[model samples]
Target: MAAKTEDLTELSNIISTNVKNYLSHVPTPPTLRPTPPVPVTDEVAAEAREQLLLACRRVISLVGGPIETVMGMSAAFHQTTAMKLAYDMKLAHNVPLDGSPIALGELAAKTGASEETIVRVMRALTLQDVFVETAPGYFAHTSGSAVIGIPGIEALIGHWTDESFASAPHISDALRENNFQPPEDSRKLAFNRAFDTNKNFFEYAYTEDKPMGARFSQAMTAAGTARGPYNLVAVYEPLRAAPKGTTLVDIGGGIGHVAIAAAQKFPNLNCVVQDIGMVVSEGRDGLPEELKDRVEFQENDFFKGQPIGGPGVYYYLRHILHDHPDPWVSLSRPISWEKGDSLGGILSHIASVMDSSSRILIDEDIMNEHMGPEGNKMTITLDFQMLVMCNGKERTEAQWAALLKSADERLVIEKVWRAKRNDSGIIEARLA
Candidate 1:
């Protein structure tokens, strides 16, 4: 126990030293640093951040020793609840934007929520360093709380706390009911169980619950933006000199941001951002005027076949494949997937249209072996969330290769356009 306690103490030291070290690096106001405020693209900074993440994970695991981690995680749901309440009540916005403190009463008045309730929610948030309490009743934003009220961010929170939150508690039930197997049917997942409807997540979002659907659309954009600005570093060279007159189809592309960015950089590439009707409409409306001729929005269902085929056509799928289980890439049973919505089904269409020169680019999180027992909890969290919301998953590199091959025997990955920043990137494939 002494050794365990010492380890925890060391993590606390890491925490204390980390703050001092990071702040020491930051230049004081009125004088900017020579280096970028955040060296997002720098390899050295990424390594530093990753070490910090490992330390944080160690502390998290250590917390389980002091207190049962299950209980700790269970109790943490209140933080989510409080956050949901805070966003719905506009508590983050009610605080003065310029860093001025607001009293509890003022916050309550702005949100039309009771002061008693406001205090409870604020108390929950402050413990997580979301909002700070300077005096007895006064509050200000911390880094965590400051971004809560941003437009797409608010919707992301809402989408998570609403349906996703509601479904998470049912994961065990969702699994046990399916004989602890990877369920191929979307409607049989936790989200359907939570909502007491047979509709799958997308059906529930767009048809059964339009408001949730709208929030989901906004949340997706917010989710992407939060990940980082659209990265084309992976496809920069090939896209810059894209095969002549290629109408690059961005399957399931939302608002066509990636496609738009691609068109601007790649003169030879024309793009058609294909999605459902609503997403197509939104993309068309938001597309920049200068790039309108270069990029076009077309209503298309990804589950259906690819529309165009030629000598060297391009198909780009960003963050799309992982949202499904590959029926062809079996879990408990080989050739198990019967659902038409499987990754194999989707890839089959693209493969059918591919010639030797034609390319398919999958931009997704490809999980890899990392430094710790449990690597990158965000990826794990997403994997579970997919199980809860859509009966989907994240995949390893081997699994990705298997999935593509399962789609078509001749399909082969030519390269991985890996970014310096993270494990997620574009996998470029062509017919063998």
Candidate 2:
């Protein structure tokens, strides 16, 4: 056998060639929407983008200096912090959208921020390709900065900057105080420690202030925007396959997004969106007139017993489980688990009501088995966010399987449908 070797330069060259070739084959994306610059509409383009991005990252790491690399890692939070400040100051909104530039002093006056502060923050973002300095002292919106001014995206920025940022500092404290244990109660998590409150994030945001609750809802909508059409409904094939008039129970469904989507896609599939009393009421009112006949809203706490039960129905929970802490005990056979408290109790109740034909659909991000250098970054980041806010976590495939088995031995994993060009999956479970 011939001894073959590759140097860093050669590796970089190969990666660069691969990236260029991949990009060359794909159609060029527009600079802005309604013709979105993101190649999200095309599956092949999306996959190509993934490959190109990984290659580019590899090339950068292989060529970059160790000191500079470490410095960039250390200063990673600065970009987010500056972006947050930009959002806070409404810099994106103040900047001209028609390619004309706003002088630093004028922009500062509009935002009520100092000219010097505005210059520093704008310059920082400009370097990152967020905004652009067309002239020596004037700034204008780039494709990146323009989107943040939208109500939904701005709300998302506010939620992350104001709510999530507040909790970041307390994660270490919460971990240290609990002896590095995941706190059992959500109230004892990093968010509570940061604000010195007993209420959970949702409770604080929803009950304490109505406007904040509304913004949180908008923020969630905005957060999902990047995913485009690669949604839970698209991933869950059972909905399309089900017979007409099949009922889907969406438990803990906030504002009934999934149910609405399902009802719209599968006209014959009736949906019952269940959540807390307040959310249910809001959902009921917020539902479109066309969907009103197909989709209905109900008030029900999932921790309590199953509210509705029947054969051939699908109970859907999208992005719900990760907000809950790990199970404390098994639910197989019979156990002294209290109702209206934990997921085990809820699962047991659901199992008791489920027939062999019925299925429970969990649509969530199941973490990769081995989180490598090229692993999904959003899932990992969200896992920590869950940890800090609720002592919850994004579970791996094995963890999900184990959880289902532990919840109820009869609750077998029927299938896991992971979507192409997306990390989200639909895990369908049924009674054995």
Candidate 3:
């Protein structure tokens, strides 16, 4: 026990030192590091650093080692039966976003599943705190589940639960199958064998009346409507404040959350939300009676073409590019080398309409293999889901830059910003 404690302490110290080094190089925000009336004394600054390091050490000790935690998560990923049950219960219960207590029988009824099945599933989820049982057979939601409840969460979950994602259930298969890339026919074969159908997973879900499809739509709306409204406003604030007559086009915007947020933030700025007809119709129904006139939802399939011609402040593709692999390249190529025309085509379309001043902001994870075990593992997991569902793949910074560079000769990346709410990153590109 003493030895264990010493090991934890040393690990904590290492984490603290690394954190301090990282923070030291970043320019402190003016609000966070306001100009002091008097110069900061060395002794005071040193003491502050010590306090910060101690706090970091405490956090590290509490969380345990990064490697250990990652290994544990990898192990958990291998154990999917538990996750699936938790997902089912959460969907059935109508658990509040804030996570109030719920009854299992009630959830079972709502989901149209048997009580025994629900109970068994809940047992597994409760173990992981995906759903917390306040009492035996009674559960409550958590922040983790609440986030998962957001509209897009269902799509993500549905994609994962599909047989395509399940065929190679072992993590070793994921790692060993050259990061889970198979030839196109072979990939299709795996999926068909799993589902006993040739149809893609999404199409299959749509046909089978999987609640996950609608839930996915709602979850996407929840995530976008909640974080998107504010973040969209903030991201476009610079453009909003720019010279008048600025038109902003939201590309593949599901239900105009970003556009609505922008309109609310800057009433003077003109905005349009472009998406598929089905999504636009759904969004239109849910729009506040007042904002319908102000915000227009246009039927535009970004994969084919963007209808909005822009001399706009921003052409934003939020969480869209990550859903597609490089277009022209065959799916068999190493995901890193698979350069395609889909993303490039969209950017080219946007560029054709842009003036020299227009900008493009892509909100997605700019994966870094070296960031830490948490990010790397999560990204790879997500990548596998993408492969199974949509033939899409996540891109690293170099991959993103390469795509942007190839998309339009006039476009140049200005900044890559990280989100405070999640591990997502925004790659901001401007027409040079």
Candidate 4:
């Protein structure tokens, strides 16, 4: 036993040392590159390169097994029935939004099941920290579960988990086909089979049963409301400081959350929230009566054309563009483009309205293949979900740059702001 313990200790030390050495050799990301390379003698450069290579190799050897273990655990957790059942139990228990402590018997009664079943589900969820069994049989909601309480959260989760939509179930087929078609094809088939129509997933969700549709809308509103404040503060605060009474247009601003928040944050800043007629109609009653005069909701479709007659400081788009594919010409055909003639075409139109000093802030996930572990995982998962549901794909920085260049010759990516909540990055562009 003593010898085995010593061996394990030595192994652990070796693993730690290798990881440190490996990380030390990682090349600086291109975005972080200096203007010019520092000159070094050939001998010294060669020695440094050799050391870096050796360190990386040693680190890989030490950590490869453990890394694979972590990846497996992640995959299993996402794809397991245990996880799904636990989520369902939590949702049905109504513990998250209820904001009250729940006893096991009460949870079981609420869910219309036996106490044993509820206990088992709670125990499983407890393992994932989705909920806590505070005192053996009583449970409380965890922070993780609160976010999922919003209406659209469960629908989105369900949509992703459906056997026909999940990429995990089709990954093997995708590998064999050497195509991204497996999930794509499955999504198309599922929607067609279920709804007998070719509508986008969100559109389908909107037209579904009362509870589900309401949930979807609520989820979207919740997501926008939760992130809207931060996004506005991150970009608008600086812009607001530059000049007072700057009119800001929020394109496709669902429910006017972004505009409302901005209005509250910058009392001097006039704002317009534009969307389709239905969304604007729904959002009308939610705005404070005082804000009604200042923050107006317009029935405008961006694809048809932007209408605020801007010379505003900035135009903001939050979580909007990822809903469509690139090559805006091809992408615009199937969808409604009433706001502007085309997705790319509208940018030119929006640019025409903007003054020389105006800027565009797009608050969406800017996919970075080399983002840190948590960010990479979440973005990649979202990317696949986009593909399956909307035929949309997340874009890397280069992809975004290309899209902007194609959209309008006058628009240029000035800088990108990374989201604090996750690995997402915001592309900030200026009219050139």
Error of 3 at 197 (Å): 5.9
* Candidate 4 residue runs with Cα over 4 Å from true position: 1-106, 134-178, 181-196, 208-213, 224-229, 242-244, 329-332, 336-349, 369-375, 419-421
Models, CA RMSD each: 4.7, 3.9, 9.2, 11.1
Candidate 4 accuracy as lDDT? 0.60
Top-down lDDT ranking? 2, 1, 4, 3
Put down candidate 1 lDDT per residue, 1-432, tens digits, no spaces: 122343767767766665455545544321111111223444544554565666776777676575677777778778789988887788878897666789888888888999999889988988888888989999987767777777888898888888989898888887897688967777777888899988778777777787888788898887776766565633346777666567788898878878887887777778989888877888898888898778998887666567878878888888777776676222212221235333436788888877898888888877875534436667777888888898778878777888888878888888888766666777888899
The numbered model that scores best in lDDT is 2
Predicted candidate 2 versus true structure: per-residue lDDT over 120-142, tens digit per residue: 88778888778888889988777
Residue-pair clashes per candidate: 0, 0, 10, 14
Model 4, 301-340: lDDT tens digits are: 5655666564556788877778665543122343432232
What is each predicted model's overall lDDT from 0 to 1?
A: 0.75, 0.76, 0.59, 0.60
- Between 1 and 4, whose TM-score is larger? 1
Which is the better candidate, 3 or 4, if ranked by TM-score? 4
Error (Å) of candidate 4 at residue 348 is 4.3
Residue 170 CA error for candidate 3 (Å)?
10
Q: Which stretches of candidate 2 lie over 4 Å from their true place?
A: 1-27, 30-39, 328-345
